[model samples]
Target: MAKKKKKTVAEDDLSAEDLGVVPEEKKKKTTAKKKTSKKKTTTKKKTTKKSSKKSDFIQSSCNVGLVGHVDHGKTTLVKALSGTWTEKYADEINRGITIKLGYAEAAVMQCPKCNRVIAEALANLLRKSKKDPKGHCPDCGEKLAFKRRISFVDAPGHEILMATMLSGASLMDGAVLLVAANEDCPQPQTREHLAALEIAKIENIIIVQNKVDSVGKERAIEHYNQIKSFVKGTIAENAPIIPTSAIFQANVDKISELIEEIIPSPDFEDLNEEDFLFNVARSFDINRPGISIDDLAGGVMGGSIISGQISVGDQVEIRPGLKNPDSGKYKPVITTVKSIYEGKHSLETARPGGLIAIGTELDPSNTRTDQLIGNVVGTPETLPEVKNTVEIETHLLEKVLGAEEDISVKPIAKNELIMIVVGTSLSAGVVSKIGKHNSVSLQLKRPICALGGSIVALSRRIHNRFRLIGYGYLAE
Candidate 1:
């Protein structure tokens, strides 16, 4: 009796219900394992959904031009902000200057804080945030999210390329005037670029004091003051000044924050409904020499849409288009927009206020070398009338810019030939008639698309090269 019968092997393996005695420890372990498996399955499903969501975070695109004197870090600042060196030309890289208009785009992101308090139980099971590249916040172990995307047009800041700067200015909703902290404020190009901004009426500006890392705090402060004074009484008088070291990416985040705050996308509710007006800045033959007829690409025009919207396959009429040698009269070039591209992003349609590249069906011979730079791409029969004779309400500046001597801006004399820039189009205009104070009518050598109140940049040859003298508005 003391030596009880050996417990049967079946009895030891009995189920809790069969044994009449509950196996509480085993039951708890089983429940815990099931819960963990469920949690893992739920987490994997959630992560799959979140990762599938496309990043259409860029709400609306705005062009912000970076303008300043040569060697002021305009290109460097662009590289810092967008991680791209805009100068793609060989000569530009060799010369260490932005020769043509450079372009880059970047997205500004922010950390996504944990909305739910990190409970001890849930903390270990939480997923990483999309906003924080590290997946988890170091402080509270949260995630991050994307904020906005901004496109920067890095314009050449050289004195000789003021025309290019002005052309780029026409596409900007705002501008960044870079002033190197190591150099004196109000460098010639800095002043000149600021003045050009004023003429273009670009009110939103951010003044960047770059190269601060190369100087001490005292020197940086001095440069800041110089910048404040230089901008005082000018268009950028109220603009914010952000000190940064573009070479080292110091305080570069501040610049991005400022851009998002100051250059908010424009309200295009009304403008988008109006007729389209695309200013052709640069056009080229993208086809290579060896390409066969079947594989040859069409002509590509790169520029910004000043107004309205254009979609793929839209029939557009280019005004003052390819001048037909046989017919002296200007003939409109009719073509369909084969494709539209904004930066590296492709789009089916393009709206006002962002740079776009349009591929068209046309003769490549007509587009190479920027021969069609100043043309307007618009709806057929809906574009503004092309004019060979333009009457302007001129307002001459007090002095000529980019000149060795501070020459006073003189009144337009009859028969004097001068350079004219309207939108992105450039032409030579001969003053045929002079009217009252700051009024003149000119006969243009190249026809241009002129609206009733379009602004025109006026320039004259002062020391061999043409210099910006003043701006004018198209007469009614």
Candidate 2:
């Protein structure tokens, strides 16, 4: 065999065509393609990393619920302040009562006497290099900012629908207790709702003496004083009592002002994130696909964020039956938020004082009406447990069962089934312990929904009557 001549450095690095395999340009092109492939792989990794960071920065928002007496202008006031019709349902409109939870947005408008319209107009013209701009009294021109968003859940106030009212009230951060100026004293529902608020431990309240336009200033003042005296030791004791007229829009600005003063911004951090829970006031199927369609068709989770925040794409865990199912084990189903809407506006995140509609991937059949709804989307380590025992501090409404002595001596064992409402979540649990301190521990027959540390109401079933007796908190 002839000895192969030693190839030079350039000769050894042969192109594809060196051996008549292909064109030299094609070989170069192939090599370039390989390099580009590598670049693309590197670029793809970078893009994924960037996308994740963006997702991490997006936080959740809040929710609020409206509670008060029927015909107290709760619906009208909601329509006026939120600029949305809460009672859109035919049944609700026809009955002139909020049978179900009616959701609306609370629109924030600037104080006509405080906004700087002229300055804003001048700034706009300056940017456009235009002068002699048409001007108006800045002090009188109130504008709505897109950023300042609020929501409300108009709850029913019918005497028979106290459960519904309590359900709605449980999900609120603060409450706007509407009392008509025309009434000499608080209605039964008014006192009931106030009691419910106290049970839920809702600390922020703005007492609105609605229909003030119907009453002259002198009478309105008297009405205000009466209400002031009524709420003296309660949450509304120090609450601003603004006289308002939704029909005439008189003192309407005052409602907005009070809301601004009372409703804390959504940006504020909740000190109680670990125990954050949202109660579902209403669940409906939508005619929409995927998770949203499934969620809507299955069930639209409606409630207020009692604490913490919830965002789209969050993985939530549903504890059905509050108690262990037939298997004596709590059933937990995990799902993601397909979509989130506040009133009608689609949102990426929701805070603690607005209404939230969560389209979930859960099968409606599996998730019962009053199951405990919570997000397993955050730190699982911090997620609350589906506890059987809950500690409570309760208040008994006089018309119903009178006192602790009224608790049935027989057939009603401690830890027996009793209805409880916290936020919008409602379910029946067994009374685990009744303390001498007027507190009780409920070993919920089912895992009634709740956030630890959240205030919950207890109503025991005695014969044919449902008695609102006490309030409690979820403990470890």
Candidate 3:
């Protein structure tokens, strides 16, 4: 097949793309992006009953991460797997790098004809629209069966956004590590991200040897060897490596198949509802400009539930939530869950798995511009208490990562400042005391709400930018 006549679908006003869809035309020296109008979710007046019924079904999706070095095709792979690109910020779009944590949801569909699970490439973002109608197999015109929806958490690969990536990893159930065949294996972020995944304790990983379209056969094979060598004896040592040209939507079905086979959804039913927790990664005021107060919707909280379940009308608390500007003190915000959404579909109940949004009864101003991000949401009276300081058990790696040169990790010194990340929350703290058992007490600059025994990612400022030094857990 020739590439010259192919037409790649643009991000806006689209549902999904299929193998039946064409790839974007490419130039040897440049990559092209087509921007469409702002996304809207209004369904046609002639909407069918089946579509409405499909929309009403309640199903939770698991998270799958797209992580690796910058310019290595993580976003492109997301575009291939899910028709919409994840980068929405003007800076991210203009710079061609994911600066914030970008997310897009794609459903894994199985072809009835071949029984092959494949990419859900035709649907537009569930985040942007309320509809996620299924698509047909590109192989056969026969309709495809819906397997499961997996949220693609597109972590920023730039060294500066390492903290952002770590926060996003807290939501992921599994991840696909993207490595471009055109570059050397284990680029700085490639190594750092792998370490972060290890710290996050994510064991399910798939290596995507991307850009085979740009590299020759010999070069591609050599890069494969490099990837294998890089992951040897690491958490991803047994992970499968899938070669693909995400730019051309090649071998995406194989990636989808593995996501279904290897990355099963969390056993939500087995999780005790008594241990309820939600990690807030984003917050928003969905009201448009010029909307009257009576017509304005309540504020929204976006994240994944870590355990148990939540529902409409349930009373919940947002901890370390709103800050009192005058006194600079933080307190929990208790509110009712007015609505729950997985993508565009409104749900009566939200469980642990993929990304979701909880519509609360608070003023839209409170949630505007992610004011409530990095906070925890849970049962009102049972929520963890907000803390201004904490003690943690530590685990340090021998060498520092994300640096140009290898350097030994230095011991934590008293009074030194460090960044600590836990379940989408990030805080800077001063080391107040160092215990004999690799533990340190920290006086936090910003208050945080997390359960005991939660994983903590520790980073030290290096050359004015923080680099991950090690990880630890909150004391029980």
Candidate 4:
């Protein structure tokens, strides 16, 4: 009868105790693993939230300027990025020199899973003839429905076009310095541009050593070394030099990545809707009455708003001249945004970093180039004084001046004049004082704004025309 007793299900299945396994210990280990995994999941969620907030602040909006020596593929690189020809003029393409400052618009997106920044995808999406209204992340397979508007200014690089280049760079937050990889070193214009950038106080620069396909790896490396030597002790000394071929579309993706890293995002919180500043580069009257259009608007002055909001009837100010005519002079002009255009479409209100055209009581013809226009416009802060004493950091061209020599010590007598170009304004000034330290001072023949830390160009006043002499940095 005892042998016939039925075995329990737990005993038939081999209980932990019978198998010499410790049930209490096994249960404790399993519980520990569950708790650890739960903590890990919670930590990961918190990290993701923090990362999202940072991204929102850093990628709100961005602006990049294209600069370098002539024929260094500035326009080509821009076209490659946006897939739209920025320089459409036949003469400009044929002459191999950008005649004027050009502009184009695009958007940037980010990945969901990997959270990587993406460019050119928006340009590609916009290129489609059909309204593909949706976007996806290139890195992760997740959907990227958000968009950030971006603006690109294509600046000319020729020495003769220095004024145009300065105008373009003055408005940009970042610069793309394109150096041809085939050339042994940057040309004279390249040096001139570097000086101009220094004068503008532009700190962020991305160097693109283009034309790598033509030169191949060996020569490209050689040219790259030359670039390194050329940029020594300059703001661009440690700038990332990306070797690319715009014609071949090689390393084109890297351009966007570099831009995303260098350019700072617009500060949306401190921005104002009506407080706008639009520098007038090109202005003309339209067929419509009481309305004018600025083809190439200069520096846009307004607070950044990332939430996609702007409205019409916003009051703005317009400053007609570059150097302040009066110490505290501002011409307040009220205008409503007659139309807002983003990339070729019209919108009632434009998000930040998008091109906007406003219709106002101010005549476009009256708005001259180099003028600043904005809402709540006040006299621009007085630029550094143009004095008789000039302190400069200079580089001599053609062995005419020595780097270590104080050329100004043998003072040019009174009425000795030289050319000065800062930002978009160019004028002549006479040597007023020459100090013991390679420092020389000039009292501008015509009153012009010469800010401290500005780069000043010295030219021989021959035939009453300014001839290229040398370059110097303004000092306190």
State which candidate has the highest TM-score: 3
Global lDDT of model 1: 0.75
Best by lDDT: 3
Q: Give lDDT tens digits, candidate 2, residues 171-245.
A: 566778889888875766777788887777777788878887777889988887789788887777888877777
Report the C-alpha displacement of residue 408, candidate 2, in angstroms: 16
Model 1, residue 241: distance off in Å is: 1.3
Worst 10 residues of 1 by lDDT: 11-20
Clashing pairs in 1: 112-144, 129-143, 131-144, 131-145, 374-425
RMSD of each: 19.5, 17.5, 10.2, 23.4
Each candidate: what lDDT?
0.75, 0.59, 0.81, 0.55
1-476 per-residue lDDT for model 1 (tens digits)? 42243222221121111111212233345557766778878766755674454234242368889999899898877776666677766577789998877777665545466433221211222334445434343346655345555667888977778888888888888998899988897777787788888888999999889998899999999989999888889989999999888887666656766787788777778988999988888776655444457655566787887778888799899998888788777888899887776665556777876667787777767876677888998989988888999889988889887776778988779999988888788888899999886789899998988688988889998777888888899987
Let me know the TM-score candidate 1 reaches against the reference structure: 0.81
- Superposition error at 224 for model 1 (Å): 2.0
Model 2 ranges off by over 4 Å? 1-64, 111-113, 116-147, 213-222, 270-277, 288-299, 306-312, 321-330, 349-353, 364-382, 388-417, 430-445, 449-452, 461-465
Task: Report model 2's TM-score to 2 decimal places.
Answer: 0.68
Clashes of each: 5, 32, 8, 13
lDDT of 3 by residue, 347-382 (tens): 778788888878778887888767787899888778
